[model samples]
Target: MVHGGEEALMRQYAIGDEIGRGRFGTVRRCISNATGEALALKTTPKAPLRDPLDLALAEQEPKLHLLASSPPCSPHLVALHAAFDDADAVHLVVDLCAGGDLFTLLSARGGRLPEREAAGLAAQLASALAACHRRGVAHRDVKPDNLLFDAATGALKLADFGSAEWFGDGRRMSGLVGTPYYVAPEVVAGREYGEKVDVWSAGVVLYVMLSGTVPFYGATVPEIFEAVLRGNLRFPPRAFAGVSPEAKDLMRRMLCKDVSRRLSAEQVLRHPWIASCGSDAVAG
Candidate 1:
């Protein structure tokens, strides 16, 4: 995904090597020349003649990045230091998490994380989502790959806003957006959903974090979509032995198929499993 225009900005950071590739671009490990700080730079090609979905996805990313950075209570969102569009590509300099994404970590550990560690990460994610909801933003994508953990502080950040949107009083949108497995049933049904969709995604995320696999999965995308639509939520009893029952209860509340019955970010923060995370924790 690296293009020449991004090379200009990459020079400013003294990029040393390629880190990895994301859905729409590539990331590189680099050191900031000005501050002697290490970071990751993500680059995406400009959409002069890209597919409709790619163009829409690129257009959505930066808007949500701005919203995430604006929330003071938000957990450490990837900091966007600089950005610019070249004749052929778009460049973004973002905070680098050397510890990598949750997916990488989970893969290295055989797909399961220790209960306390997973709970801790989930608490931070819930807090971040609560902050976004307060500001009328919804992180339409909430899977492990989009969750990054900083090596220095062990702090978690929610990344990839390609499907996120502002839905507070002044701003609202209707469309089917988000990865199929993580998308809420209402969204799949073509209903006009609000931020509660994020709660559903987050619940799926929490379930995966605890159980080592998604609650709803099928051989095909449409089949998976059908499972989600049917509200076929099942958890492995043995996989959740040591985790708190309250944690499972909270996930159940958040993943309710009916958006009206689903718990709000603030309410989730107030739930027992979340409350135990901290006194200052904001509930959703």
Candidate 2:
């Protein structure tokens, strides 16, 4: 619901230079007028949006994000302080992540991360997804691009709930949503699925971190979808020779073709590799 332009968001936070841009709008750096603290402000204009799904997403994002941030909020999540609305745009104030996203981190580090570091990052993402799942919110899009890092501490935080959906009441969610490289097979097949899809995507993220390549890949979108449908998970000896067996086993369970056999986020936290990195990861 759009909060009538009754309260001016600019009165609370001074909008500054543009920092990033997305499909719907731009993200700018802003500072609180009261405490002199810095934050990020996302402004999405509503005028140009006419598609039903796009409009639905613009409204659902803030609500689902707030639901996931209820009592006992996870630090792994990029805390959204408030959301403001007007006739022109929707404003979202969230914690600033100046260290960039996981994609940038991977690119800077020669396309792959060491096992211990990968485990730590994976554990953090898993913890974040676990918190989202408990609240019945499924983050349909779980990729490096949406995982941001802090400026000073370099801590990881999951962001961008635009593709997230509410799956409460034990109800299954239907619809083809998510990035092709990270989307689950069930999702690609247009099947009704639940929170487990997040685990599958997270598994793909972890696999990419460790091997610097996707498990199911192709030259085109159709080829990639086909490979994902076949569900043949493998660890090329050249890329996975140094990887531990436990890590490989964990990915196997996560990328399993049988949704029932897939492990949940909480179970992923209990995995040996993730468990060993628990101290470094945010609470699950």
Best by lDDT: 2
Candidate 1 Cα outliers beyond 4 Å, as residue runs: 1-11, 47-49, 71-73, 277-284
Off by over 4 Å in 2: 1-3
TM-score of 1: 0.88
lDDT of 2 at 95: 86
Write down the RMSD of all candidates, one decimal each.
Answer: 3.5, 1.8
- The numbered model that scores best in TM-score is 2
- CA-lDDT, candidates in order: 0.75, 0.88
lDDT of 2 by residue, 1-284 (tens): 33445266877888899998877888999998889889998878888788777777877788998898766889899888778877777788888999999998899988899898899899889889999999999999999999999887777899888889999999999888888899999999999999999999999999999999999998999999999999899899988879999899999989988999999999998898788754465654
Compute the lDDT for candidate 2.
Answer: 0.88
- lDDT per residue for candidate 1 within 107-201, as digits (tens), equals 88887776666667777777778778877788888888888887877788887666678787956567878888888999888878888888898
Distance from true location, Cα of 190 in model 2, Å: 0.7
For each candidate, give its TM-score against the true structure: 0.88, 0.94
